[model samples]
Target chain A: MKRGFNFSPGPGTLPLEVLEQAAEEMLDWCGTGMGVMEMSHRGKAFMSILNQAQDDLRELLMVPDNYKILFMQGGAVAENAIIPMNLLGYCAETPPIADYIVTGFWSDKSQKEARRYCNVNIAASSEGRHFTHLPRQEEWKLSQDPAYIHICTNETIHGVEYFWEPDLPGVGLPEVPLVADVSSHILSRPMDVSKFGVMYGGAQKNIGPSGMTFVIVREDLLDRALPICPSVFTWKTVAENNSMYNTPPTYAIYIAGLVFEWLKRNGGLKAMEKQNVAKAQLLYGYLDSSNFYCTFVEKDCRSRMNVPFFLHDDALNDKFFAGAESYGLLQLNGHSSVGGVRASIYNAMPLAGVQALVDYLRDFERIHG
Target chain B: MKRGFNFSPGPGTLPLEVLEQAAEEMLDWCGTGMGVMEMSHRGKAFMSILNQAQDDLRELLMVPDNYKILFMQGGAVAENAIIPMNLLGYCAETPPIADYIVTGFWSDKSQKEARRYCNVNIAASSEGRHFTHLPRQEEWKLSQDPAYIHICTNETIHGVEYFWEPDLPGVGLPEVPLVADVSSHILSRPMDVSKFGVMYGGAQKNIGPSGMTFVIVREDLLDRALPICPSVFTWKTVAENNSMYNTPPTYAIYIAGLVFEWLKRNGGLKAMEKQNVAKAQLLYGYLDSSNFYCTFVEKDCRSRMNVPFFLHDDALNDKFFAGAESYGLLQLNGHSSVGGVRASIYNAMPLAGVQALVDYLRDFERIHG
Candidate 1:
């Protein structure tokens, strides 16, 4: 059966090869006599899987030896609160302050959840412009001696992404740590490991599956967890335990390990980034040339993974979706908050899939334009 | 290729039919053109799966309409902290007190986590007796109007289980809600859902896999989250959103849904309980009649799901495990804390598997005893 091009913001498309491999191994992984899900987390077979996944991920991203990569549950949403709970107490001020540069929905959430544990300072926000653009480094108002500066490198909902890392020193906050929520676009490009204190994301997009959050935190920041942090979520305990603090989402990690292997087999992050850029350009170029379609996000800051555009006539929206579905295009409807169409072309999305989407756009426009 | 009898406590064996069905649907789920993992959480196909799973579980457990079933992330370990965070604030007391009945490892952890949010009282403890027996209802020392009582209905690490509900009324504390962690034993038999305010478990053992936590909280107890509770883990928020407050463990829920359907087809909980009883009896009866092997947990309180035993000559432990592995029996090693053997026969483990195990026990004794 031919699979549809899945453009869902997250829990998005995965490589067909990875899915096939997982299916083949579903009943019995290797000759272990038990499936990955059925194996004991402490057993040798599963321990090897866990260790290999962590190592592969580390190698793929060129993660520094000083940074601890944690396999966690609860996605990016749980980490919103977990981050503050871990970092604020580490700073240990009379009233620890955390600065956030709110680029879109996710970073906005991060700051709000942090408000529960510490004083929050919105260093800058692009919400005043409907999240169409990212707040520039010069615009950021860093709080003096704040625990950490938070940013969402890619906003899945608003379709904006940071092309460059936040410069703490450029903003006169050299000692403050930089934390980023890169959920929608982690492996889509190469990232400098030393630029941030923490880089965390949900693995559903540009990786594999939901239920697992990959956190890369500097070793120095591991022990900053507040007394209230759950033992399993405390960075120090998790790092010390090698992310087996609990069961560590065995199957999700297994599937993600397959994805990391896939990444490595396909020329690593640089190659993935090159393909991703090409896919994004094809879709965006077509959107720019079309008279019947328009995008709300500023071009300079638009997300390569998520492209949110709207029909010239809103009345044809349902028909547009129906036509897209018939052509094997799926989940193109924009987020409810941003009413339109969204094409999430992540690392897993092939250039052929994007070309098919472009062909559909032209066919749809020829009839309606 | 034959599958082994897996007995590794949590993340133990799963129903073969469920695994087969999942493999069949791995590429394209019911003509939806995407695997279950690729579907958007908000999409109709995945939503139906989530709702159907919730409904089937509700029917199977006979959960009352007043109870809210929350599909949450983070396994039982994370819930050790989440439960206290959600419930303590509901009582609205200055430095609220919560009572815990420490039966074993899990209950001890639950109370220790509760200390972060509220004052915790150890109402009764079986640790003094090496967790071999359950403290009777009369032995529980009630706290004066504590917020709630916590218990680990089944201790996975140590094989003790509560066969009867805590009689709060008889203990003169009818008003206190009871929260039980039934991770290892959930769905093994019919549970009296009305007796507890909350029943939660990690899905790895009897349900499906790791990464998903099933939380059944009474409706009245929904809004009592402490000020610092993560919004995503808050019961009321998750319940209202139909477990879609965030991208839930989508694929895990789908696999669990398949298990639920399998449970229904196999004559529901009563039939499952009968088979479970037979399996437990076969294993325990063999141990009782054998001079070479013995179980640590008391007979009355032995968990049907988990059985921990020891070889009479500790030196033979390695030989016993190697022999068992040769017989296609796997994960027979006990937890590191308890150096012995544990056989976790969850609902998914058929009676035939237990029979094979008993046969192995007899054969090993004849050869080595």
Candidate 2:
């Protein structure tokens, strides 16, 4: 049975092969006579699964030896608060200031959540332009001695993305640690782990499932959490326990392990980035050629993972979605906050799926343009 | 292919039928082209799964109408801090006091975590008795006006359980809310939801997979979170958002929904209780009759979910475990903190598995007695 082209923003499409392997191993993993979900997290079978997953992820991302990979819970929204709780104490300021480069909804949320723990500095923002572009580092008005500067590298809602890594020294800021919520596009391309103090994401988008959050933090950033930070949310505690601070979501970790293995078998992140770029170009090119559809994000900042496009005639939106669904293009509707259509082509989306979507877009245009 | 008789404490065992159905639905659920894990949390297909699961659970537990069921993340250990953060603000005292009945490791952890936010009073304790019995309410030293009273209804590690609900009025205490962590035995029997202000548990035991935490909080207790509480851990925010405060552990919730349906089809909690009582009686009956094996937990307070017993001679412990493994018994070893054998026969473990375990016990005793 063929699977449909799932373009949902998150809890997004997963590789068919990976899902098949998971199903095959559902009853008994590695002939252990017990399902992976049934094994104790501390037992040898699950420990092996956990360790192998951590190692494979580290290898795939080329994570620095100085960083620790933590399998966490509560998604990126939770991290909006956890990030502050863990980092606010590191600053010498009476009430630390954390600079935020607010590109879209998620980064704005991070800034607001941080206000509970510290004073927030909106160093740079594209909110005046309705989040149509990423804020350049040179334009940022960073505060002196801030705890960290945060950015949401990819905005799933508005389809804005940062193509260039921030250069703190180039921008005349004195070595403020960079923290990123790369939730939507963490594994879509290669990233320089050493460039940031922390890189974290929810696993639903480019990774495996929805419940698990992955954190890659520099060792120096550990143990700086405020006293009020929950022990479970404290990165140093989680890192020290090898992500087993408290059960660590064994089943989700197993599925994520499978995904990391799938990525390795398919030539890692460089190959993944190539496919993502091609997918984005194919969809954006069609939107560009047709006067019937248009995208609001700036060309230079358009996301390679999520492309939110709108129809020229609002009346045609329903028909477009209906037709797309009939062609097995599922979840094409954009986020409720920004209504139109969005096609999220993550790592698991095949090139053929994007091709089929373009075909549907052309057919719809012919009928309704 | 018969599964082994698994007796792991938590993340312990699952109903075989649920595993089969999950495997079958891994590719497409209910004719939806996307798997449950692949579907967006807000999509119609997943909304149906989420809603049905919530409804079925409500029906199975007979939870009160005033209580809201929240599908949460971060597990029970995380909830130790979350509970205090959410409820501490409700108290009128300058720094609110919270009473704890520390029956075992979990409740003790809860008390210690709460101290970070509120003053914790040990109202009752079984630690002096090595957690062998539940602390009787009659002996509890009630404090003046606490934020809430916390208890671990069932201790997975020490195999201690509360068979009776605490009568707050009977102990001369005001209407202080009762919060219980029923992680290991949530669905083992019927529970009166109105008796407690909150009941929360991790899904690894009795429910479904790991990573998802289920909270049943009285609606009135919703909005008292301390400002320091992360928005994601704020129970009122999560309850108001219908557990979609963040993209919940979708797959775990789906599995839990399936488990709830399975429970309803096979005679709900009342029927589950009967089977559980019989299973516990069978194993404990055998242990009581034999001088070769003895359980340390007091008889009346013994957990129906986890039964930890020691061999008469410590020398035979390794051989006992080895022999049990050969007999298709798995994970019979107790928690590392408690050195012995433990049989965690949750709702998923069948009568025949317990019988097989008894037979193995008799055989081991025959050889080593």
Candidate 3:
């Protein structure tokens, strides 16, 4: 806590409690006399840790029995290819088709990776608008009998969020399954478990750490994977083995379990959502009310987790960053592609941290606005 | 360290010092105000860490100017496919035949994966002797003009080691490049960097934790990858970007850097190898002098890192394990295939720990012999 509240998008801050507990348990876990890292993934002590972690994660997410939760590596970027390779089996040969709604950087990457696996229909894209907003659901031109419809519910870099889950049934796309990349905003609010066919994210942002990703997939989608899919990335194989098909990232899983436990103890997703709303509102309210700062996303689509705003005077960007650093709200600088300030308020970021940033914003506005 | 001495092959024991330093640095690194995990991979602070880690690893291994180092995931398992996809470009459109010298489980897996890429030739096998030995180089029936000769320098499961580096120049065959999976015994000793075209392994064993694999390849091998190889896994692309083609497993890299620095502090690989030899000799010596237990590997090929042995009576297997557990010895259970015991004296497992296990063996023999 010596530094200010860090707000790097992914590979972001973890709860201090999780880090403390992890450090405390490094030499010996539950009196097992071995660090979790040193234990074999198959040994009883580590197996128990692994089992409890999976079980606790299942409980926390309330993952349906039919759906499998895979713990994997190569981050979400890998899943961009892995998902299509695993799910496109539903389509007839020659070349399968999948639908994508490109919100920002992540969905674009996913769509590109999907292209490698099948014919991809970019049913909707806000890219023409420079991804300042997510296109309205009605604007999409989804494919007929597509493999799946992919979306990034939260665009980390663009700071746009889909506040509402697309109602495929209401939209007359009843049979199509929707997949979401919730990397930046997952667990910051409540999500409907039943609405989506799959939800995947790298653990770096809202989850726990790098080297692991959490994928919640419907049970029905488990069986069909392209033969080209690496065995390690197949959802069915990973799910059947309980994420232990290949040696799982043991330490990452353990840390994630601790995080899940922490989330539970601090009042689950509902409680977290309340805090997130408050923090987001405080930052956005400040940004909107100030003429000195401008946020690009439409109000309806602004992300609760990320608020990217640029000062009116671009020349002062460096000064703003340096001033913010001195005050301890680190990583205030925005994405390179979109320069300015971005404060990512993930589950681990306390409300007070956000308030502190808002206070700084106000004080800075008073001086430089 | 409360456990007697964890000798389980991998995700094995790590140094007490490294764990302590890691624990202390878990939340805040170097008083710089943020934990390593919390930093963005591209940030200067994290880049410095990543760079130093790569540089130190390069320095420790004495990697040549031409060779590029890749810190990858999916361990050697994914590497099974990745290796061939990268190297098969040296072959024609039909893909040249590849030679595999099977020694143990890992090499067997590498062979199976290679079949998906090229015409695989089993150059030699010691499996006929139950993997208790390494087949002599002269006995190998290598294919002429094969793309490369693949071998596992350290077979973790069967505990048969290739202690001597093969001088391919004198083999009187086409000077095919050599590829070795040095997963289990890397960093434990000095390796002749110039002798290998490509070497890769999972990090769970001797490196740091699971999920991180280090691949050291000679420069010329970079451009030889088959076109189908994933852009993310292309060694040349990874090398050019300094392994940041993807996130590069930030935390694992951090810990491995700590391990590398620790290795340097403890008198480099030469000193560590001496310690490892003494530790392996101590345990193996006890097993040899006693009638109660027996190691199956040939005298010439026994692994200096992994020593798998069997008790004279199978019935006492349970009793032996239970007794060992009570004495705080952990993960000494043998591989299921072998139905005996394996004590992996990896670099992380200290010399005193090995001595203690040897003492336990002597004490056990007094009662059970």
RMSD to truth, every model = 1.1, 1.1, 1.7
> What local lDDT does model 3 show for residue A302?
92
Clash pairs detected, candidate 2: none
All DockQ scores = 0.83, 0.80, 0.65
Off by over 4 Å in 1: none
Q: Using Cα atoms with residue i matched to residue i, what is each candidate's TM-score against the true structure? A: 0.99, 0.99, 0.97
The chain B TM-scores of all candidates, as shown, are 0.98, 0.98, 0.97
Question: Worst 10-residue stretch by lDDT in candidate 2 chain B?
Answer: B167-176
For model 3, the local distance difference test gives 0.85
Residues B1-369, candidate 3: write the lDDT tens digits: 464577878788888899999999998888767888888888888889888888988888889888888888777888888888788888643657898999998899889878877899999988887887888888889887788889999899999888888767779644478999999988888899788889899988887988787899988778888755666678898899888876768888888988889999999899989998898888888888888899888888888899899989988889888888888889998877787889999988888888878888888878877
Largest DockQ belongs to which candidate? 1
State how far residue B309 of model 2 sits from its true place (Å): 0.8
The interface root-mean-square deviation of each model, in the order shown, is 0.9, 1.0, 1.7
Candidate 2 lDDT over B159-262, as tens digits, reads 99999998876766556889999999998999988889999989999999999999999988887789999988999889889999789999999999889988
lDDT of each: 0.91, 0.91, 0.85
Candidate 2's TM-score:
0.99
For model 3, residues A1-369, the per-residue Cα lDDT tens digits are 486688888689999999999999999988887889998898888888778777877777777887777888888887887888788887754578999998898899889877777899999999999898778788889877788899999999999998888889988876667888877787887788788999998888987878888898998888778766677778898888878777878888888888888999999889999999898899899888989899889888999998888999999888888888888888777888888888888999998899899888888888886
Q: Scoring only the second chain, what is candidate 2's TM-score?
A: 0.98
Candidate with better DockQ, 1 vs 3: 1
TM-score of chain A of 3: 0.97
